[model samples]
Target: MLMRKTAALLLLSLPLALARPMSTLAQAPVQYNVAFPNAVHHEARVTATFRELPAGPLQVRMARSSPGRYALHEFAKNVYDVAATDSRGRALTITRPDPSGWAVTGHDGTVTFTYTLFGDRTDGTYAGIDARHAHLNIPATLAYAEGLEQRPAQVQFAGLPAAWTVATQLQPDAAGTTYSAPNLQYLMDSPTSLGEQQVRTWQEGGRTIELKVLHEGTPAELDAYAAQTQKIVREAAAVFGGMPAFDFGRYTFVANYLPQTSSDGMEHRNSTSLTSRRPLRGPGAIDNLGTVAHEFFHAWNVERLRPQDLEPFNFSQANISSNLWFAEGFTQYYGELVLRRAGIYPTDTEYCQEALTGLVNAMMLSPGAARFSPVQMSQQAPFVDAAAAIDPNNRTNTYLSYYYIGAANALALDLELRARFKTDLDTYMRALWQQFGSQQQNYAPARPYTTPDLQRVLGEVARDTAFAGQFFRQHIYGHQQPDYPALLAPAGLLVRPARPNKASLATRLSFNAADSTATLGTTTSGSPLYVAGLDREDVVLRFDGQRLVGSKAFEELLSTHRPGDVVQLEVRTRTGLQTVPVTLTEEPALEVVTYEAAGRPISKAQKKFRAAWLSSKVR
Candidate 1:
């Protein structure tokens, strides 16, 4: 309440004229088509069907080339035959919108520009199956131009097979998918995906919410997906004084898990695309929900209330600012908040402990900790780089996407801030809302959040609360890791001797399940049995046709050699299975400074069982 009052006070101080542009969605409508009949050599036809003609070079731009990444990507390089047309389908004299789009003069009708995008569909774009099964993000791969972007008048799709479905955060259509927003800004606010969609919806609090996943996973595996998503979105909205985004809006979750893709997430405005070649069920399946929640939370923070550098985005240049920690990082923190809020996490202590353990492990295992400040330097990361804006717009290398790193900080910092106030953190968001929510509609208002910004916001909730400002300087602004043990202690998560999360073949051989049994899983370089010439699933047998009993026996034989040495093993054949002698290769190991020291050595009684149980490198 106080934050709201403070915001109102701040608004009253501002000139009345500047506030007008924030609330107005005053822009003409647009319609685009991301058509890819073939996953290979796909093209997106962004037709800005303007309802009215306006002055200026009628430019259209894309925000960096991809979503979940903040960089001005000149998607024009991906565009070809940048021509303009009138209602009769005749070419209208069009010029370049700084090279990314076609700028036309005169009357506004259906002006279309076709841009060919070779979206690395197969081996290159390893997130989804093919172009036909891909999700749209950043508007570059499908549609281009966001800077002078108009609301899509009628984004029509063509050259697509009937089996394909287009899923969007728009009004549903019986004949086809149609989304009608109040204005162009709202249209730009939502994203769409055209592919084979598996939808799941549920009714909660007297309203219907939908979850449309675009990928190649089994529908049965995603049975409980709607429920998991409901918990995440509902709890997240509850944090910021109830949900601010439209209750009826859609948030698409994209999945692209080729044989091998990075295990991470990229968040967008209305939807988020995840990397998943696996099922969205069982314990591991919940990974999709984590990302879904992460992206869903952004609807309030980044989509509406945002950073200044990000607002009124510039396509010709890049934004060299650092504020993603607030937008992306905080949303990430809320991702798990939804989990805990849903009772998926038993207690605050457990949540804190789990997050701390992951952090501590990353700290211990990372060798580039000195060179990288994930939270502070993420603006320069690959995900935020201006490849789309810069010439040689190639992102084959620079692989640093900072949302996860920054989000972790947001989670830790918000928790710390809340602890200092001895109150729920939602109060802070309410304060942000009261101060800027409605009036600060455009993204630019949240540019550089300076000392005064923190002071005023924090002051509103906690009288004389200067801890937030201090925390920002000491831990957030530089290459300094947050004081995790100290910040989370008040939340009651005691860090136990971290258990190494590795698996061993020796342990597999020794399990009580049975003898002469084998586990079917992927092979690894650091496995002891693999060092013993164990190729993935080469069943181990005794010498001279003798059978090895268990994983325990397997580990006892493995502790004998250092990594990089070769060992021989007798095994089975296709007639059954056979022994294949292979050399052990040493794998990169992160120094153990960050991960908690292994507790005192295992007891003598437990030593036999423990040694062959856990392998050091599996993930």
Candidate 2:
């Protein structure tokens, strides 16, 4: 019966709201015919149609960047075999004006450009094609006319395997083969997964959630995961009062849990794409659920209540935002919390333990946290957030992940709000949802929230503008670290000195068993290794006159020593072999423990605070 219900629901199609452009000029919509005839070659033959083009040089350019990503991908590098044809079946003169676009002339007001694109990567930002199927991130696969970007678009798939299917946020025609998007931005944001799939659906608050999964799991496992995902959706909705108005009266989770695709989870306006190298089974499945919670929450935090800087996302340049600390970091903070609130973490003590152990320790131990503010790291996202690769740089010492900082800041702010104003971060987020997220406003590039807006919102939530300013100045925009030991004390988390008093060079070392060589992956900025001149990728030949065999061997040697102990190391550097003497230091000793408070009895007030913060049920 449940199986029949699920099947029936999957077959049901809902009406989609397509926003028509406000342009007065009469022009035909852009059409794309994508085919994967030779999928084994990992190529997509794409043909783009244009009507009533002006009698001049027309430029068709591939996207240099993607939405939600803050970097330039230069997608045209994979496009080849470009040619233009007129309506009379005559070839038009095509010329490469730049690396990413083609200029064509001598057409009779109608032309079609045909090109071949080779893509093998499967993630949120790139496209992938193979014998089994083709997964498309349209920004990397489709080309658009310079001035025709605002026109409506239609896409049709051809030459796919007979058993394969299509899953996207795009509005499907009655035949279900054709999908439509209001504009290029919406088109690019909608990723299509073409393959065999198992779809599951659940409805809440008059909204339907569709989970389309491509996995190797059995029907029972897939069904179970679908139910679990539905629970997660309900739990997330409980946070912001209710769901954000989904663009099409629905939200889609497009997942490719196969060994072929890379691990990633990206949030879109009406959908999210979740790809992984593993399937949803066993305990590992819980880890992937965290991503689902995170991306789903983005429907409110980023997709709608977005920063002004990222409001009108630019495809030709970087879309850097100064508020990712809140957009991405706060979402991460709540991802785990939502899981805990859903009874996924089992207990409040366990949840607090994981929070302190993972988020708090990371912020406390990260030297970069003290070096860069959360806002500064958010501004630096264009360089670190999957940006184009460059030369070797020291990110460990100089850069901190905004995700880490934002989460820690969220924790701190939540604790402070509860401690000072008797409220929590949820109140602030809910206020934003009502003002910025719930209205379902069309994509407006000029209406992003600014720092002043954030400050105002925080002030309204806490009822103290001065307190909000202090938080922004000290934590968000400035490098003053949050005093976690003091802030988290009332929550029953015990901060204590870690045992072992262990010492090391504090360098991240990777060892190859086949070659018996240990290479430094990352060395602390001022640690023994860095001071001794050990650099990243430097292959260690010997430690203390002994041939270094593995990372374990190196750690065993360090275990025998204490802070301020001198050691000798021989390394193979790019400049050649060099022997350097180094002094070790004590490893990070801050430890977080949950419940019992290190032999101290919990007071009734502290217990009340802890329960209020970690209880699964919302007030």
lDDT of 1 by residue, 1-619 (tens): 0011100000001111222354334544444544443454344333344434444445555433343345555545655645666666776676654555556665354455444454443211222324445444434443444443433334444445555566655444455534444333434444555555677776544445556665455676566666667767677767675555442444555555443344556554455556555556566665667666777777677666666556554434555446665676567666776776665555544554544455544433333333355545556744444343333422212222354456556556555655566554567776776565534333234343533464467656766546656656554554456655555444333334332322223223323346664543333333555445444344555532435556566455445544555445566634576665545433332121112133333344333221221111111
Clash pairs, candidate 2, are 308-448, 308-449
- Per-prediction TM-score: 0.63, 0.92
Q: After superposition, how far is residue 318 of candidate 2 from its true place, in Å?
A: 1.7
lDDT of 2 at 452: 79
Model 2 CA deviation exceeding 4 Å by range:
1-26, 157-159, 349-355, 443-446, 497-499, 512-517, 537-541, 570-581, 597-600, 617-619
In model 1, state the lDDT of residue 291. 67
